[model samples]
Target: MPIEHAMNTISERHRADILIIGGGAAGLLAALAARRKARERSIVDSDFRIVVLERNARPGAKIRISGGGKCNVTHDGAVGEMLVQGFFRKSEQRFLRPALYAFTNDDLRRMLRKRSVPTAVRDDGKVFPVSGRACDVLAAIEAELRDASVDVVTGTRVRSCLRQNGVFCIHTKMSDFFSSRLVLATGGVSYRHTGTTGDGLHIAASFGHDLVPSSPSLAPFFLRHPVAAALSGVALRDVQLSFRTPSETVSRKGDVLLTHKGLSGPACFSLSRDAADLMRRESGGEALVNFFPDFSAEDMQEMLLRHASAHGKQLIRKFLQLQSAIPSGMIPLVLKQAAIEGDIGWGSLTKNARCRLQRTLQSFSFGEVKAIPLDAGEVSAGGIALGQVNAKTMESRICRDLFLCGEILDYAGEVGGFNLQAAFSTGWLAGSSSASGSAGTGV
Candidate 1:
């Protein structure tokens, strides 16, 4: 949507004690937190009005589509484990420490449970609704908001926000909103269809907060040479992916999905930010895939020699299909890449051929990354700089009553449930602090 100038003639006007923009994961939780904290403070509900302005027709559009419609609400674990295991950078870990601990994954789960939305934790630690429906999670949160008497106005596009005489004047397309405390949870630039188009970042910059120059994070890579159709849906488990950036080598280990375009899944998404950065910096950036991340070249050679000795008459392709971890569909491609014949017996393989095969297995070239579209990312990488925001309160240091939460902040977590957990945590802290009118006094 195009930005329009605030009109002199206001169609309508609304007032609230606390106003939250963008009713996404963060905004919805922020409204709930504010309501809960206000009650705890003995503030009369009728006297203090909390409002949420959402551009979409309904709230939590992104949430409904997350985790392939299952909605990975959060990662099930202690806050420390989540911080250490899910987030990669130390700076990000430090920034998220307080909020994540304050409103933990367990807390989130408990809230869902109360709303009659039972959850199940997968073996990989992803917490999802029992019914496997993302809409159920959104519905539960919406129910909480309704019960709390938090007014959520949908289809409201904010044109501009300005602080005038200790009041935040938010000019939307339909009406004007005024509030003392404002929460910007407009999310990031990714998932444009869901209404997260970096509006919050722009608003923050207007309020004197620096931005980190947005890029696509947790996105798939489109390769120059696409993979074969047979390998399109094949999944590689426990694989490592390495990409060379202008500054350093970025590597990640997890499961990878071979798409016809290139790669997807946890491992590829993890490296996407760096890969996108690398592509932006220069062309011809190549990714290397390590099918056997746990095995060294010598170990692989030794294993191959043992297999050959045991089954001398076994065809190389047949050995790879039955004995190796390489997928059946990928054997032909692997043989071709290694310059080996599929018909050749393992016993007849030359020493040079064995070494080539070992090398190929260790670092198979995934080809040059053609593109990593920023809009295609699950979450964006940049937003308001973290140092400008009070981590404990989720309030901006530059602007006192203005709080920023969710993907609007510069931290973008890995794929899974880390991002949503961060959103909930920060939103809770932001709402709680805004309601209490002081930092560290929030619930």
Candidate 2:
């Protein structure tokens, strides 16, 4: 359908029983879940209308661009496994327990499967559609919504939202909407081009909900000293990245990709939140990289000593490249940091040089980090404070009949389908609770 026609369809219908703002993952699922719940309760479609308002020309803009367009629907695991592997903080784990269990990854896959969108899980446990197209995932969701008789309004930007005499009023560029219940799923400020501009945050705050200060999470660093062009695309597996703050040292271990600007991949992204937070208070900081995260300093030293004694005639650079698994392009930089000559024979290595090399191998400095761009993050940290919303139902404690879900909440999970799962889980809970008109105890 044309964008103009979609907008026009909603113009005449300004009232809904459940109004959802932002047609991304959360909004789409919320609408569908509400309709499903309503049907299960024997509520007629005429008695309960669900409407979704989206700022973009179509819904699921972020969904279409996620996972390089393949769309990592959700991680492949049980609720407990996902909670343990995907979320780090205990608070987030506890708060998300009910919702995640209520709507598990299996449930999401089953829904897609029913829509004829078969999914496959990668070796690393990231699940994607078998066709490897993000549009297929979005199409499945759209199909479900259409079958449920849910109304979706696209290209309509919400100007403001407020509650008046128990009814929620939402003003948009196209028209005004009123609803008894509203779901705020506008997502975060990250990926502004995809229409997530933190509109929901403002709306939530206006209704007396507290907000956690927003920051960039799952973003790459911009180094003070950029990687060499030759080493730009080089990648390392099982590396540990650490950043030092005044209080303590934060670390993460995973695969890393050396970009032309600085560092990316799972390791860098995992530590980016801490790096970004630290850099926000301090001007800049350095990230230390341990290429051999599995080996201790003593283990590496013993191995290198044994190798040097056995291969006395071999050049240090050649030994590092062949045995240590260090990239050829990085040898020069590594040697320079250790203050050792790359061409020097292993037998000619002095005690001081060997020690320096060992230390460098254990904790090689990546570089001074200038900043972690907030806009470049896959998901932004912080949102409406978790305490302000009920964990079981995703309803706002401060505002009756107003529910919150998705990136609008203060929980930001790690990459590899965690964020999307949280969105889906929370949206499902919010939709079900709101449709049933049940109030949840705020935890």
Candidate 3:
């Protein structure tokens, strides 16, 4: 309950060496890093002041809500995935490499260990904080800030910033503050209710930063099939998700969930970014997706032909008896859609019927992806263009003393744990770079 009531402080002005806006993962990390580097600095000292402003009552609220309420702090994979061939830009990915590898999943666990936060590693190598409590994640961050004596002011809504002389002046609903360097980690517009209301974009845009258009990522899909609606709650492990774009066909296998609306879970979350992008490009038009990708059309055809040849002496069910795990209810629909009549016995199945079944198994085309509701998303795809900022310092190229990180930057990833990793990495860079040798004297 760190969230304070909306009470204005009404102070004329405050001063700091580093000012960090937004206390989510990135902001908190920035404040902590500055304090560590500043060392023994007074909050009131003009030489070393570090302040963190958060609009929410408490920091890390979004981090608290991730992974079905189990905050996924970071991933165990190599840091290489953050850029270029890995998924993000080279500079943005490089910014994270230092802290990501420096701290690592083991380090996060060791820090959370004292709080009795248990951690577990999934088969894919994604690590959870182990406590299964978002508060543990928040507590770990809050503890760092408190230990460093970093000034954390909650419920402070920023209006704008003015750069005068070499310092930037910050105006907020609560009061005014000045800092030599400013970090904008206000995040993006994915979870509006959590206070990520695109506030940073306005402030950064006001300062002339090049921004890439943003759209919701890792969002759910909406389907037109009656069978989809019927199997809404069904979930399948080891299932594959294949996307068909005009130029290429991409497929990934993992866990897949059947939502009341359509498909989701790991497979869907992985494809969500590109799906939303293409879906928007088509202007509400549909995209084709396949639920089963491991078996090829040829493989399905061969299996069906062999089954009918031998089981032709048995009932339809007898033909599929070897694969009874597939729900009996879906068998008829799958066969019918493939143009294989329901009444035919396995022995009577013709070569033409087998080919149709091959099509169904190899490519069960699902309809277009519907509009993704912003609040339902985990992250957004676009943000401050990577080329416009100094990756080493996260300093804005257009606005001196201004830094951008977190979702405000174009570094995002899949559902498991990459988002938090981006937050920690960028926050660390902004903080250390802002506090390093010459930027500011005060903490």
Candidate 4:
């Protein structure tokens, strides 16, 4: 944050064959692709005259904070699933396939290793740099840009963009820039502290791209239940959070952290993506949690009954406290909420109390979700319509010589490295195609 734009930082107005307005994953990848694809070293080519402008003084600030500083570069899953069912439409998937193929997750790992950041791939196939530090990932990527001879301009902000003589001219607070090709890897609206202030949407909208209102995806929820408040600090693992719409029920399996607000962690983050989407509009949606997701309602009821029958000599208060299923501090509260007196031993339990225990433990319900704000998320949903782009080339059909990639287009994937993979794929295509100037929005 101590970066200052000395006189050297503001050299002069410039022109480039390809100008990128961001230096995040997509932007940096564009610089790499352009550097790799240029025809000749002559000014005529200028290696596509690549110039990457990042508002952040240092590149990859978000990457430094990703995966809780571990840098989950890419998920360890079949790429097909990432491209499909999560949220993107068919055309969006098609538009992303080309770049994804060009630069696979393995390729990213290899690059990181070369930069001295040894990487380890988890059993789930999520590739992380060996150091398990996001700073290392950023270092590797930064090294790539430096080695690729990318003209990266950090702390440069674009004020406006204009179309002139079929070419786009960008006006920035630092200076004006012109480029034969323009790529906006400005990222989505999430993590504003990392500099993704939704600026790309404004720039793309100015260029005639449709703007989709981005919401907080992969964010924590706020519950209205006092029980939730009482159990706020308790962390639940292997939980199932079912996201409910008017017509469908979908669930994600993982760990969820109980916050004063609601839930967080992978289970909640994954569910939050859908929660943010389905609840983006005025109509509300609800997230129902199954704490003991591994067992069915009947199985849980049977377990509770068995425990009660076995501990018939103990009081309900002692029963809850002695059990490992719920938090110890919450035993009295849980029993009280179940309307069971805490003093009576398990043997003194009436049939009504036993039934209450079964009902309370088997399936608990939460309230209708009012909203999940955009800023609370790790990623934002919706982007430029992918239908107007070329799936193989990542070229834009709406504008000749204009290519779309990353979150700039409306192809948001799930959490855990899918989105970064998406960005890498589209950025590769856009950067490679930018040199030829034949790219079209994957139509």
Model 2 lDDT per residue over 314-355, tens place: 998887888444677778888999999989999999988998
State the TM-score for model 4. Answer: 0.85
What is the C-alpha local distance difference test score of candidate 3?
A: 0.70
Give the backbone clash total of model 2. 0
Best model per TM-score: 2
Model 2 TM = 0.94
Model 2 residue 120 distance off true place after TM-score fit, in angstroms: 1.5
lDDT of 1: 0.87
lDDT of 4 by residue, 1-443 (tens): 11122222433437666788888888888778877777433333332457898888988777878888888888655557656644445665666666777887777777778889887778766777777898888877888887776788888988777665556677788667766678878888877888888777876777777776676667777665534466777866576777677876667888767777766777777777667666654367666656577777678777767877787777677656655556676566556657888888877777777777766653444556655667777777766766767777666677666667777676566666887777776787778777553321111
Task: Pick out the ten consecutive residues of candidate 1 with the lowest summed lDDT.
Answer: 1-10
Across 1-443, the per-residue lDDT of candidate 3 in tens digits comes to 11111112323236677899999888888887777666633333344768898888888888888888877776665566433323543555665565565445565666667556767777766678666778888887787777777888888889898776666777887667877789999998887999988888888888888778878777766655424467777765566676565655546676667777777787777777776666566555343334345566666667667766766776665454445334554566566667766667876766676676666655655655555555567888778887788876778889877888788887667776778877776787788777776667321
* Model 3 TM-score on a 0 to 1 scale: 0.87
The regions of model 1 sitting more than 4 angstroms off are 1-13, 245-247, 438-443
* Model 3 residue 227 lDDT score: 45
lDDT of each: 0.87, 0.86, 0.70, 0.70
* Deviating ranges (above 4 Å) for candidate 4: 1-13, 39-47, 81-95, 224-232, 243-250, 281-287, 306-311, 317-323, 345-352, 366-370, 437-443
lDDT of 1 by residue, 290-324 (tens): 88888988898898888878988999888778735
Which sections of candidate 2 miss by over 4 Å? 1-12, 245-247, 438-443
TM-score against native, each model: 0.93, 0.94, 0.87, 0.85
